[model samples]
Target: MSRTLVIGDIHGGLKALHQILERAEVTTNDKLVFLGDYIDGWSDSPRVIDFLIELDKTHDCFFIRGNHEEMVLRWLTAGDDNAEWRIHGGQSTVDAYQDLDIHTKDRHVGFLARLNDYYIDEQNRLYVHAGFTNQKGVYYEFFRGMFCWDRTLWETAMSLNPALSKDDLFYPKRLTLYKEIFIGHTPVTRISETVPVNKANVWNVDTGAAFKGRLSIMDVDTKAFWQSDPLHELYANEKGRN
Candidate 1:
């Protein structure tokens, strides 16, 4: 059956992205949801965006806005060049666009601007670039900012006692709100292996393609995953925004 595949951060690692897609055997029948941070780390930020644009034209694809995309959009539309974004890998994206024509550059900006903060499928599976803060006594929409920057959500899930039943009164309601929550941003390598990590129904698929790991893609329902080789090997000689 065609599956709904959710991919994690690309971070400008075009080679890894292509490899993971091929490894997953993605077909036009599948629905692909990207968890964002598409630009920044590797040497082909512009190329990555271009590939995504074309992929969207040919398949069912959803793109979520990541902090890096937010920073770059701010720079493109509002002229706000935040240092934090630059230090975190935005420089590679900027450098990649230096030679592009205004039309192509604007297309990139338009694509980035249209990214969603989070996407919830009919099955109540939530897909977000980062995690959302379930502010006590408030609706989730009010804390949308958390969807793109919250580390606490993942950290809290990681800290939870694994033995608790889903119905345990003590189980976090925030985590139970959705059947499953898939996120990127915080790389899985920090917690365990260089693969997708699951904790408290939250699956983190960002295997750190921007840093030292590979890019990842997972079937939303089956939890089956695929990854590229370590990004270092993919782009053997490049520094890759390090």
Candidate 2:
């Protein structure tokens, strides 16, 4: 089987990301799937995006749109009018692009906007940036708020009701498709240690590398995971969040 490697939230930690990829021994034949949040939170947003773009040209790279990417896309499309983008770690992203030319800026914006919302393998492994709602048939609509921040839906589904039996767990009423959903948005302390909700269907790989956590990556088929130390301490100490 072709190796499918799923990378967690990068958040502009280029050094950490490079380390993890090196540790994972990623090759040309392996399929690399990035679980978004590629920009913001760190100091190398532009460099990270450029690296990914270049990697995409040579490797089988798949990227999903994370909440951070969505925020930037909103700013680029709407001209940062409401100032909502600034609140969600947008200032750093803006600063990253300040030195770039108009062509490069447009390229980055287009790249962010073109990211896929989700990817599902034939083996029933679902790859999404944040996650999908259990809201029946409309789950594929890519609802902005839900895609970027709907933890409640998944949480509610996992909570058992006394009225229903254990076997009668809440499943999406509209869709019968069941796959091991691999997601990254909410950061956990470990990469391999999954937040087991429904028989390990949902897995979170964001190890909070942009914050005080480590950068992580995992292989879907083998479940092999790798991580790198936090590289944001330098930025945090220097910028102090502006």
Candidate 3:
């Protein structure tokens, strides 16, 4: 069967990325949906983008934008930098591109620029780097940043009353916008989960590749998944999110 796999935040762990893809036995017939944060938190930020650019050439890929990717674009496009970004792993991404030629940098710029804020499939399944806040839906969201930074949507889902049905009048309207929602950005490692998390109809695939956790990918239909070894171990000698 042609599986649709939703991947979590990569956080520049190119080795883990490759290992996870292999473990999952990804085929060109499958649809790969990346939840973003392709860079930062590791030494292979530039190479990760390079590999992804090539991967898209042979397979169907959907790249969603994450908060870190947003910062990457800002730095590459307009030289925007802040202490927060640096301390949070942006510095690794910035340093990764330091020696690149303008032509190569421009190509990376195009790649990151073309990333989607959110993606919805024909099955009414939503894929995003972060959660959306608009009760109506993603299209009606006012702050574009919310697409890659909001946590309330996931928080709301987690706090949802299991006894309450979607038909209830008090159910969160935002959660009702899609049949199912998938997000990253906020790592689930913080909650002590190393696997994909499911709450209500929302699935969080970000198992925290940016930190000491593993990189994960899940089949949207089967909920079956494969994860790489702890990213910190993959790049033990280097410094990044690990």
> Among these predicted structures, which one has the highest lDDT?
3
* Pairs clashing within candidate 3: 41-241
- Across 45-147, the per-residue lDDT of candidate 2 in tens digits comes to 8899999999999999999888888878877767753455554556778877777898988998889978987787788677777666654522455565666
lDDT of 3 by residue, 106-209 (tens): 99999999999999999999999888888899999999999999999999999999899999999999988899999998889888899999999999999988
Residue pairs with backbone overlap in model 2 = none
- What TM-score fits each model? 0.94, 0.83, 0.98
Relative to the unseen true structure, what is the C-alpha lDDT of residue 153 in candidate 3, on a scale of 0 to 100?
94
Worst 10 residues of 2 by lDDT: 191-200
* Candidate 2 lDDT (Cα, 0 to 1): 0.71
RMSD of each: 1.8, 3.8, 0.9
- For TM-score, the strongest prediction is 3
Give the per-residue Cα lDDT of candidate 2 at 173.
Answer: 43
| Residue-by-residue lDDT tens digits, candidate 1, 1-242 | 78999999998988888898999999999999999899888888889999999999999999999888888888878888867777788877778788989999899989998899888889988899888766441244576667788888799899999898878998887887887888998988776678899988889999988888989999988889998998888878876656
Clash tally, candidates in order: 0, 0, 1
